[model samples]
Target: MKILITGSTGQLSQALQTALAGEGKVLALGHKVMDLTKPMQIRQQVRLLRPDLIINAAAYTAVDPAQGDRDQAYAVNAIGPEVLAEEAAALGVPLIHYSTDYVFDGRKPEPYHEEDEPRPLSIYGASKLAGEQAIQAVGGQHLILRTSWVYSLHGRNFLLTMQRLLQERDTLSVVDDEVGAPTWAGTIAAVTADMVRKWRTGTGGPSGLYHLTATGETSWYGFACSIAQNLERQGLLRARLEPILSADYPTAAERPLNSRLNCARLQRDWGMVLPDWEAALHQCLGNANAHQANHSMQATQSL
Candidate 1:
């Protein structure tokens, strides 16, 4: 099957590319090749590629900046998927889109199920919710995967940010109120590939919105503490970690206090299971260390 993946350079898309390498002909399109903000460009590219499947991983992810950039955010996160769904419907192809757990207001005390009513509190969440709605309105073959706190070894994510900050600073403060799973991009990509393969083989269940995230939950402060502990074990710098409330670190957008998503439906239907946040983090950091060691060896050999 020929697959077209948007946001090629992004963390999730990069993982998808690697995961889907043996699936079929994969055409990776970055912003330079296909800008999500431009509907006409999206239409033209989809027409040109005529791919069997289109996985939209591109999104306007600047939550704080989105408060002042609603238009751009909607253009990419909302209108882009709408246009993609329309094109997919026209071509009779399935479209796989990614959404966010931010769609919830975080008022719920328990984990959010797939059927939970979304009450977005911030502009970014609203835009992403709009995207999900727009795709459903198009009435096409689509699978909307709502994930949370996605990070990877690559990309500008909280993990890398903490790693850098821990090395550069003596003390670090993280919000302890906001709770969610720190999902690894590679895990999402691998599961996506499995779902796609099952679909192709006519074994995958019906398509709809499903929550895909790590097994457990943690606050930003807890996540940072875990990262710091691992880094210190690896002979990295040790920094004093401080836990603070969300209000202590103000931002343009209001984040949800609870971002936990229930993955029961995904597991029941697709038979997909992801590692816990802590396990995934350990593997990710281990891979990073291996990569660095290989690079250093290559450099020394060249000298």
Candidate 2:
């Protein structure tokens, strides 16, 4: 099958490329190739590609900056998916889109299920929620997978940010009040590929909103501490970690304190379960170490 995936250079897209390797023809388009903010461009590309499946990973993800730039966020995160759904309905193909856990107000004591009401706190979250609703309104076969605290080594994410700060500073502070699973991009990509494969084979269950995240949850401070401990074990760096409340570090956007999502529905329907956040983190760090070693060997060969 021919597949069209947006956000070509993003961490999730890169992982999707790897996961979908040899499965089918994948037309990966980045912002340079197809800007989500431009509906005509999106419509044109969909018409031209005429893909059997559309996986929209592209999004405007700047939480704080989104407060000042709601137009851009809504254009990419809301209008983009709406246009894609309309085109997909026209072509009679399924579209896979991603949402965020930020849609919730974080008031619930337990993990959020798909049926939970969404009350987004930040403009970024609101825009994403709007995209989900827009896609549903188009009356197309689509899957809106809601994930939380996603990070990976290949892109601008929490894991990479922690790595950089650990190297640069002897001390670091991270928010402890907010909690969520630090999902790996690779995990999302793999599960997405599985879903698409099953759907193509007429085995995939159904299309709807599902919470896709790691099995366990942790605060930003805990996540940073884990990364620091892992890096230190690899002889990378040693640093003093400090945990602070969310108010201690204010931002333009209000973040949800409880970003945890329950994935029981995903597992029941897809017959798949993701590893814990810590295990995924270990695998990511291992990959990073291997990449560094390869680079070092290449340098030595050049010398």
Candidate 3:
């Protein structure tokens, strides 16, 4: 299988590259090489590469900035995805595109499911929701995987941000009210590889939307505390954590308070289940390269 993964520099894409290393001839494309905003360029690349599978990991993820930059957000998130779906359908290939939990308004008491009606609360969320709908409308062989609170050992994420702040500041405040699972990029990549393996064996399920996240849930403050606890064990942490509500610190983009998504359907359909958030975090931190990467990031931030 010739796998084409977009967003080469992103955390999840990088992890996917590693996970799918031996599975096929993987061609990961970065923004400079494959800009999602340009439909013509996307078509050109898809036609040229003629990949057997296209995994669209690219997205406009700047939640707050998206409020003022709606056009660019939609261009990349909505329009671009629609084009990709069309192209993938034209090629008669599967397009594994990643969506977000932000598609919901977070009003429901329970976890969001695939059948839940999305009511996005921000431009970024709305854009991503549009992309999901567009792809579905295209009626192509696509897996719209909605994930939440994605982090990794490398790249910019809550984990890396907390790691640096916890080391530098005497005190740090994180939102406690907004809750979701902190999913590791590594876990997502591995699960994706598993799905690809199943597909190769001709035992995959029907193409549709699905939720893929860590098993357990936690608030941003809770996630930070866990990061601290893990770092403290390694003598690399120092900070007094403070919990605050979402209202305490507002942003341009309204985020979903309840980011938790029920993964029972995914497991039932695909026989896939993720590890708990804490265990995944522990496993991610256990990587020796993580320490070096964290130090490098912190140093870069200081300079």
Candidate 4:
């Protein structure tokens, strides 16, 4: 089977590329190759590639900046997915897309379920929600996976930012009220590959939106502290982090305080569950370390 994955260089796309490589012929495309903002280009690419499955790993992820740039965000997030859904439905293929916990307003204290009505708090969230609804409206064979707090060893994420700043700065402050699971990109990709295999074997559940995230939750401050502890253990710690409230740090866009998502439905249907946030983080760092060691060994061999 030929699998086409968008956002070739993105964090999740990178993970998906590695995970799905063994399952089929993976064709990953970057913005230069297939810009999500162009509907004609998407349609043309899909027609040309004629992939067995289309996994849209692309997204407009700038949360705060999206407030002032709604048009661009919608072009990539809302309209792009809508066109992809239409094309996938036309081709009679499945399209696996990723959404976010930001679709909610963060008012509810409990975890957001798949059935919960989304009330987005920012332009980015609204655009994502729009994309989800558009795909659903198309009545296509689609699986919209809603994830939260996605981070990886690569990419611009909270994990990398905190890691660098925690060593460079003498002190730092992170929000304590906003809470969610810090999902690892590798975890998402591995789980997605499992689901794809189940689908191929005719054991997968129905196509619909599902919450796929790490089991546990934590605040930004807590997550930062975890990273700090890891660095300190490696003798790289330098920052004295402080916990601050959300109100203390105002941004152009509002964020959902309760970004937690419930994953029981996914587990019940697909028998898919991810490791806890801490364990996933450990695995990411371990992979990075292993990768670096291998590169060093290769260099020494060449020498």
Best candidate (score: lDDT): 4
State every prediction's TM-score relative to the real structure.
Answer: 0.98, 0.97, 0.95, 0.97
Show pairs that collide, candidate 3. none
For candidate 4, write residues 177-254 as lDDT tens digits: 999999999999999999999999999999999999998999999999989888887799999999999999999999
**Per lDDT, what order, best first?**
4, 1, 2, 3
* Model 4 TM-score, all chains together: 0.97
Clashing pairs in 1: none
Candidate 2: tens digits of C-alpha lDDT, residues 39-128: 999999999999999999999999999999999999999999999999999999999999999999998999999999999999999999
Instruction: Tell me the lDDT of model 3 at 273.
Output: 71
Candidate 3's displacement at residue 84, Å, is 1.0
Candidate number with the higher TM-score (1 or 4): 1
Q: What is the lDDT of residue 88 in candidate 3?
A: 96
Shift in Å, residue 225, candidate 1 = 1.1
| C-alpha lDDT score of every prediction, in listed order | 0.94, 0.93, 0.92, 0.95
Residue 269 local lDDT, model 1: 93
Q: 1-303, model 3: which lDDT tens digit per residue? A: 899999999999999999999999999999898899989999999999999999998899999999999999999999999999999999999999899999999999899999999999999999999999999999978899999999997788999999999999998889999989999999999999999998889888779999999998999999999899887877978789999999999899889999999988879888897899999988898884477779999999999
User: Which scores higher on TM-score, 1 or 3?
Assistant: 1
Q: Native-vs-model 3 lDDT?
A: 0.92
